[model samples]
Target: MKRFSALGAMLALAGAAPLAGAAPQPPSCARPEWPQEARRYELEGVTTLNFRMGPDGRAIEPTVARSSRWAMLDQAAIASLSTCVFPAETVQRVQGKLLPLQFVWKLQGPDRVPPALVEGSCAASERFDRYVPFDKGVSGDDGVLVRLLVRGDGTPYGVKAEAGGADPALAQAAVEYVQSCRFAYPKAGASPGSPVSGRVLLKQ
Candidate 1:
């Protein structure tokens, strides 16, 4: 399931870029500007866009990037990139080079949590299970919410305790466990910035 989701996200991103075409090269590098409408469009939700920039600093090919399965927002992202431009230097340097760029669409109002941001359990059999609070005062029975950014292979790139009370010991333990763990790189198509949730539930 995880692999499929990642692949889907990649496909959406791949589809957003422009196809190769025969066009005259510009005489000099020019900074491409993002369409005003797309810029004004709110990316308040959980959406990731991956695109390629040309050596000329223009968004030669734009695609859906990555989205949280929200069609409306995804479409908006596609439309927005159509008008998006890159810096002249970027275009010149990356004209023939294919570099990945990501954009996270956020809304204008107070931050809103997407349904996908919900938490999930870390199986008892998982290696990190050893770090679970075993003592009465040490247990994270209320649960610990940690925001972990893992590489495609599932290795912890970064970790932060977001919520679930202020237990320094519990937080440290969780962070340590995560730091020691590694994950398989996501499937080839997974978006680079894909977000994964980790939940630690203590057992009595």
Candidate 2:
């Protein structure tokens, strides 16, 4: 899966960053499903949408300022971001806001977009606003793959190392770092059905 990206519409400066106060921006962790028809024919394009969010973390207008020229692609892009959960109050301090984002739909020639390319801003542990990996200058750099269990409200719990035999200290550090992170889930309220896990690559 090759990386493809384009600038989406920019929000007008009228509102500025909300004064609501310190909520970490939730990162995108999934991709909207590609239209089967589009995938069958190997259609690919980038859709740019201007989405509005309320203080309650719901999406308002999901208009495509820039079309992918493919209606199915555009709709997929809008629907996913429009309905997904976000940290409460969106921008922390801002009470209400408009967020414009661009979603690129590139077929992998394998039926689905790869998961690694799903979260645009999330980089393993870096996606969490609070999971800071330990850095030991020369002590030895080690890494662990952990499945971070994210609850409906975006709180990360059960940071289980997916593999065995990782250094105990390094693994423990990853768990602790993840425990410190928090997330906000939208309409689903406090629990988002079942536990959703995201894998994090931790290095120390």
TM-score for each of the candidates: 0.32, 0.40
Query: Which 10 successive residues of model 2 have the least lDDT summed?
Result: 109-118
lDDT of 1: 0.42
lDDT of 2 by residue, 35-141 (tens): 76555333455677766666556667778776765566777776777656557545344435555566667643222221121223333454233232222111123
lDDT of 1 by residue, 1-204 (tens): 122111122212333243222123422322222333333222123345555665544555556444433345466555555555555544545465454333344323333221122122233434244323112121245555454555554555456553435477876766665556544442345433334445545444
lDDT of each: 0.42, 0.48
Candidate 1: which stretches are off by over 4 Å?
Answer: 1-140
**Clashing residue pairs for model 2:** 18-94, 20-93, 20-94, 21-93, 23-92, 152-192, 154-183
Please give the distance, in angstroms, between residue 158's alpha carbon in candidate 2 and its true position after superposition. 49
Clash tally, candidates in order: 33, 7
Listed per candidate, the RMSD to the true structure in angstroms reads: 16.3, 19.1
Write down the TM-score for model 1: 0.32
Q: Point out where model 2 deviates above 4 Å.
A: 1-23, 27-30, 89-95, 109-204
In candidate 2 the C-alpha lDDT for residue 86 amounts to 59
